[model samples]
Target: MSSQRRSYESGHKPKCLVVVDDTAEWDRAVYYASRWAVRVGGGVVMLRVIEIPDQNQQWLGVADVMRAEAIDIAEQALDRASGRANGVAGITPERVIREGDTIAQIRKAIEADVDITTLVLAASDGPDGPGPIVTAMVRHLGSFPVPVVVVASSLTDDDIDALT
Candidate 1:
């Protein structure tokens, strides 16, 4: 609920919140976040978001099953991402799974964790245009709660290593 960040507090370390959406370039975000954590002595928190469409209440049972399935997929994706972060920087990232609107969930996560000081995202470099999240985020540029770092997907691991 607080707008103020606690990352600089006496006992807290800054953390980067990386969304582990199943994008082709998500690895770039993870790589940057993990490396930054190590270089700055902070931490990495990987988040997987599952979006469910509004449906009839009559399908409550179906919704439960769908939610369960989504959670499983989210876990698998986070596992692979977590492993990649560990492999890249020898650090295991904190994993978070949330369901609902992507931006809303991301905001909630940041609000709940005061130490999360930055959001690391990867931009789509293909002809399809910058990724969905990136497009949606344009609306919140200045009003966003935390600073966002959008890494270009075209950047190779070596390129990111040099930058981070």
Candidate 2:
């Protein structure tokens, strides 16, 4: 086990599960998770789920192509997330890429793999903003095993200046 994982096992600190989607919104969750991890001497798991299209006998080739694309996208997203987290101090995070239903996969990772003491999620901007994805995540949160933290996006510079 890694030193970070060992720390979690020893109950020396908390473990955070961060669900990473291919969107700028995830930055909010990552930032919050990193901040909390440092404050509590905890570790983070950045999980990216690449949904595989349903396989059909006649569409094996198409499915293969889609799977490859999904893998590529997930890898890129994970790499960027890792880099961003690394740039921050005292926020070492582990990266994981898996296939299946995003919510189900994330839940399973938290339950069976990650020793998650908290679940940090980026809040969806709503129906006029991001649609079904936000709904699905909200629905799943009700049954999540660990405590869930939702981080809303920060205001833009223009918006902040306007308030003043």
Candidate 3:
């Protein structure tokens, strides 16, 4: 048997990976994903993406204040998500903080983490439409590496409960 086929068959674990942010949309996504994870006997992985700003000038050994601030914001967001996840039963989800473009980071994580079998995200209805990250995934990926579950901003508590 080919190594590729072997890896493909074994790599997928009964786990769900969810992107978490400070927005209400993300909170809804996390709630639904956590419940689903509990019901399916799978674990959840929370990923927080910090988009680093483009620095125009070289900082000759100087500290990058913007990067530091971004990290702080990211940490706070992760803490909020962690607190919410505490109520979830079954498995305690692991949190990951990454620095880069959201889409790129997500793609890298999906490729590197073989345990992830599903990707859960949230989309908000704005003047432009759905959240950019969700839209990007749907547009560029064409066929995502794993099945994606998108929780909308308008989802009610009952809607989230129905996920389980």
Candidate 4:
């Protein structure tokens, strides 16, 4: 929590933060966020975080290469997500790429931007259950910086439109 939100006050507008982690159900979240932005006259923020693995001394030189690769992938993911959001609501979303724990990065993004009032995520339909982030989010839902909206993987565009 970072001070009182200034959303809908003059220059500031409410925003929905959507994670674009290249997950199988990422589109669901983006769609929901885009629709929400259009309906409520809010904005959208898309975030992609890179979770880099630790490397040994022998792999010192490879760290740079790995980081470069991760950044490139992050850019591509954000591009696709941005395209989808634009197609849905004709709104260009603010894209952010951070390197670290997903949940921590999300918190940083929200703290960095006061207008972001909601987090939208899509559940994975795997037999194991919803994806890790969504599962983890369930446990911390009560203390998360903002309200979260979880979209089911099975939802169609029409289903989302009707709900939003």
TM-score of each: 0.97, 0.79, 0.82, 0.94
| Superposition TM-score, candidate 2 onto the true structure | 0.79
Query: Clash number for every model?
Result: 0, 0, 0, 0
Highest-lDDT candidate? 1
Pick the TM-score winner: 1
Q: What tens-digit string does per-residue lDDT give for candidate 1 at 86-149?
A: 9999999999999899999999999989999999999999999889999899898788999999
Task: Give the TM-score comparing model 4 with the true structure, all chains together.
Answer: 0.94
Instruction: Return the clash pairs for model 4, or none.
Output: none
- Candidate 4 lDDT over residue span 127-147, tens digit each: 989888898777788888889
For lDDT, candidate 2 versus 4, the one ahead is 4
What's the lDDT for all of these models?
0.93, 0.71, 0.74, 0.92
Give candidate 3's error at residue 163 in angstroms. 2.5
Candidate 2: Cα lDDT at 55: 86
Off by over 4 Å in 2: 1-13, 124-133, 155-164
lDDT per residue (tens digit) for residues 1-164 in model 3: 11111223544446677888656588877787778877776668888888765665786223378678877887788777767766755457888888898877877777767767778888897676777778788775565677788888888768888767
Candidate 2 lDDT, tens digit per residue, 76-111? 888888777777534558888889988888777776
Worst 10 residues of 1 by lDDT: 1-10
Ranking by TM-score: 1, 4, 3, 2
* Candidate 3 lDDT score relative to the true structure: 0.74
Residue runs of model 4 more than 4 Å from their true location after superposition: 56-58
lDDT of 1: 0.93
